[model samples]
Every structure is written in C-alpha cells, then in structure tokens.
Target: MPSSQTRPTPAPLLKPGETVVLFDGVCKLCNGWARFLIRHDHQRRVRLAAVQSPEGQALLAWAGLPVDQFDTMAVIRDRQYWERSDAFFEVIGQLSARWQPLRLLRIVPRRLRDWAYDRIALNRYRLFGKYDTCLLPNPDHEQRFLKITMPFVAKSEN
Candidate 1:
C-alpha cells in the first residue's frame, strides 16, 4: 500500500460517477455551503462528505492532504483532487449559469484568492459557531451523501 502521505489516485473511493465535496463537518459555514450546493445544484452534480467522516478521511488521505487538520475543503472528481479555492471554483463553475459568474473570481491571483479563503475558513467556527455534530442529510437529501459501501484500502509504498 502506498503511504498515506503520498497522493493515491484511488478511484474506488468514489461511489462511481459522482463529484464529491469534502468539507469540515462541524463548521457552520461549511455546512451552509453544503446546503447551498444542495439547493442550487438542481442537476445533483455533487455529493458531500464531511472531512471527519471515514469517506472524507479516505479521500483526503488519497489526495495526500492532512486528515487531522481540515483547514481546507476540496473536490474529488474523475480521480482528481481539487483543493482550496480551486475546489470552490470547480464546483460553482459547474452549477447553474447564475452561479457561473462566481467563477470570474478565478481571474484573481491564486495567492490572493487562497489567502482570503484561508482567513475565512480558519476562522469559520469562531465567526459562525460550530455544530456539536456533523450535519445529517435530511430524509429527502440522504441520497446526496456519499457512503462507503466497501472498505477503502490504501496502496503500499513501493
């Protein structure tokens, strides 16, 4: 098995043919973002997972991200990991055209963009408060969450 520290392109982590959003489960702001996604994503183009969950841990480890400190959110699709602001733009750009204009934020320098994102993200819990537990999908949106049907195995380092 490859060391969790190295990026592992394990497509099996995905429940097949879906874009996944990896987020901070307890962060009210992140939960708000996830709900926003659920509401506007009429196409149902993405599934959400909290970074503290097993599924999120597997995806983050596969992407060589820190599983302990989820200071950033990411997107996984087509066996690729899109992190930080890149992940933000990737999902919004795929949403309805009204949200498409948000993608223009991409033209800003990545350093500046990520810096702003980091400030808000790092302070999310303080600014918005946190949930005692992760968000649970409502009965109607339960299917929009990702669940591990089978155990995820990491690759050994060569």
Candidate 2:
C-alpha cells in the first residue's frame, strides 16, 4: 500500500491539536453521540463533520475510506485515521480525566470490541432511527462543526 504521506492529493486540513469526528448525520444514535461529545468536550478538542459533507468527504478520501458507503464513525487527527471502536477511544482520549476510566475498555480485546461496534454500526439506523434529511447542528454548537452554514454573526475585532 502507498504511504499516506505519499498520496497524490494533500491530506485534509485541520486545526492544530484538533481531532475531527466524522459520522452519519441522519442517524439518531450518531446525532446523540455528537451531542454528547459537544456537551462533554469542555476544551473543544473535537470537531464534528457529517460524512455527507464536503469536509468529511475530503477526509474520507484522504483516509482511503469509501465516502459513499460509510458505515462506521471515524476520528482523524494529524493525518491519521482511527475507525470503529478505535475511533471511539480516540475521542475519549481527548476528553478530561473523568473519561480516563473508560480506557479500561481497551482490556476487552480489540477484535471483540470491533465486532460489537460493527453490529451497532451496521444496524444503527434500524436499531436507533434516522432522519429523512441531515439534522442541522444547534446554534450553540454550530461552530464546532464543519460545513455548517450558521447565520452570520458579526464579531468584534477587539
């Protein structure tokens, strides 16, 4: 396989030290997870992106993932892609110390963890629910998402 650094196209850009989470915007379970991340990531270390969005598509392409057949959520940072259960841990790793305990889940063998994750991901829409259209992010958290077109708000240059 060709190295990521040698890919013809440039890697998707992200803010320094920021990890971008790409998920299915229409899946209720996924939307809920996004809300949970928004609520707990106090330092705003994570950014959200819907797999259907331009930014997410670019990242997926860069990661050599199938943008059209997206089945699992992913976390990307510093040109690295973390998928399935690993993606979950990647985001958890960026959270506060309170989340440190969750790391113990790693003790459960990655293959098993990934198998469990696959079951949910494959049936996410059926098990949870899905929207006909992608739900837009709430105004309060719009800034944390990529490809969102929130209403214009002037900022003081001070």
Candidate 3:
C-alpha cells in the first residue's frame, strides 16, 4: 500500500450522491468480493469499476495514487476515497443491515488490519489466479458499473 504521504489528494470520481468501488479487474479474490457486494448490498448504492480501466486510471491519477500498482481496493463516496482496510469497513458499514456486522472488524487497529490485507493482496494472484480478461457485469447490473472506453483485454495467443 502507498504511504499516506505518497497517496493522492482525492478528486471526485462520482457525483455528490454516488459511491463507487474500484477493484482489480483480474484478481479472482477481488471478483469474489464484488459478487459478495452484489448479493449483500440490498440498497445497491455502490457502483463498480476495474482499476485498470480508463475511468479507474483517471480517478487514480486525480487521487494521486499510482495507476500501475493496484494493491488495495478503494471506496469512493461523494468526494472522498478510502483504501485498504478503511475502504472495506466504509463499504460494509453501509451495506444491508445483516451485513453491517462486518464493520465490527474495524475494532482492529488500522496498521494491523492493513498488514493482513496487504499480505493477502500480495498473494492473491498466486493463491487465486487471475482472469484472462476483465469481468463484465450482467445486463441487469450494467448500470452499476462505470463504463470505460478502453477495457482491458487479454493478450492474443500466438
């Protein structure tokens, strides 16, 4: 994870009332989390974006985060952005009432929580593998995804 001193000064990625989640497009674990959110977020108040997409890159640029290294999930609410463990808690806290209990994990210190998060993140691809291409949302959930002109594509086989 990027240090606070190196992290970007956030720029607005969504409208004042919108909340967007930026995740690694090909990370299997991240995709699972996205699916989890879809199932549990009864209010459907959040939108999703792949960190490698154009919009994601632009937002990262504006937020002063490195576009090349996506080590943490981000939750962008209104004009604010939270990454690492804070991002997880922020999103879970707003989820369905039954899911809100996940927020209790915040009782853990930020450093310890982020350390665990980073460990899993570092091994995510090795442990869970990666998708050949970015995952597209189902038609019913299309509106919940931020469209990017340039989507990630898997390299062609020779």
lDDT string for model 1 (40-137, tens) is 99999999999999999888777778999989988887566687888898888669999988887778888888899999988999999999999788
Instruction: Using TM-score, rank the candidates from best to worst.
Output: 1, 2, 3
Give the per-residue lDDT digits (tens) of candidate 3, residues 46-68. Answer: 88888998888977776777899
In model 1, which residue pairs have backbone atoms overlapping below 3 Å?
A: 1-155, 1-156, 1-157, 2-155, 2-156, 2-157
The most accurate candidate by lDDT is 2
Query: For model 3, which pairs clash?
Result: 8-63, 8-64
TM-score of model 1 vs. true structure = 0.86
Q: Mind giving the per-residue lDDT tens digits that candidate 2 earns over 1-158?
A: 11112345435668655689999988999999999999999999999999988888988888888989979998877757788988888888889999978878878888899999999999998999999988889898999997634588999998
Q: Model 3 clash tally?
A: 2
Model 2: residues with Cα > 4 Å off, grouped in runs: 1-10, 148-158
lDDT of 2 at 57: 90
| Better structure of 2 and 3 per lDDT | 2
C-alpha-based local distance difference test score of model 2: 0.84
TM-score of each: 0.86, 0.85, 0.84
C-alpha lDDT of candidate 3 relative to the true structure: 0.80
